[model samples]
Target: MAILSETPELPKAAVSPQALVGAASPLWAYFGGAAATGLAWWWMTRFTPQNLEAMFETAAVAPLKAVEVAEDAVVEEIAAPLQAAAELVPAVTSGTIEAAETVEPVMGGEAAPLGPVAAELIREEEAVQAAATPVRPRRTPPVPPSSDT
Candidate 1:
């Protein structure tokens, strides 16, 4: 006669990779979907049409304003030196002309008279005028018809 055990040994449940994955997949999907839905709902509640429009306008206008400011700054940076140069041009021109007028003419190791300078200036003016004039193409007379066709 064998002694009878008070409680039978229970079988252990086997956890497999496929079963674990199958069990966890739906749970993960459910939580992911719930989180996505909650986020969407929150987003919809938080941002009304007016709020969205305002946000879009802010997003659009900020960069444009920044670009405009940058453009203005660049233009100012570039224009300052150009403006200074432009301002100096007339002064430089007048100074050059005055210096040219005050310069003593020297030629052939002697002080030359003003007459030659005046004549040279006249010749330069004539040359400038000739250069400014447009040149026309010369026309050639038509050849006579050959006697033997």
Candidate 2:
């Protein structure tokens, strides 16, 4: 009775590769994939900087680059004479030194040495300033009030 109660097992059915395809129709699936690709392309184009920097072809870009270099050359040509004139100007001129002047220390710090011309100029300046200022008379003690008053 136990053997009869146990049913015989049936063989498993074989599956073909074709049976693994998605349930959606082929046309709809293809269209959905194409739509997704198109959407990604549109999003990239819309969000990217001015459609990816206005791409230039070699033929058109080469001429513009040449013009830029020519412009730089023109500017340098125009500045040459001015630069030559500036170079001819001297930074220091000769001056006769009459006497030496001591350089005062700044903020109680160590004093710095001055060139002969600078010292002479400083001495002349000090002399001029001294001559321009009027000398004040020495103050005398006030006279004591008279005892008789």
Each model's C-alpha lDDT? 0.84, 0.79
lDDT of 2 by residue, 1-149 (tens): 89877988878767556765667335677878999999999998888464434455666788999999999999999898999999998665333222223445447666788999999999999999999999999999999999996
Q: Best by lDDT, which number?
A: 1
Cα distance off (Å), candidate 2, residue 99: 47
lDDT of 2: 0.79
Candidate 2 error regions (>4 Å): 1-112
> Model 1, 1-149: lDDT tens per residue?
24456566778777655675654555788888999999999989997456687778889999998999999999989998999898887655777989899999965777656798898999999999999999999999999999997
TM-score of each: 0.27, 0.24
Q: List the residue pairs that clash in candidate 2.
A: none
Candidate 1 stretches greater than 4 Å from native: 1-50, 82-149
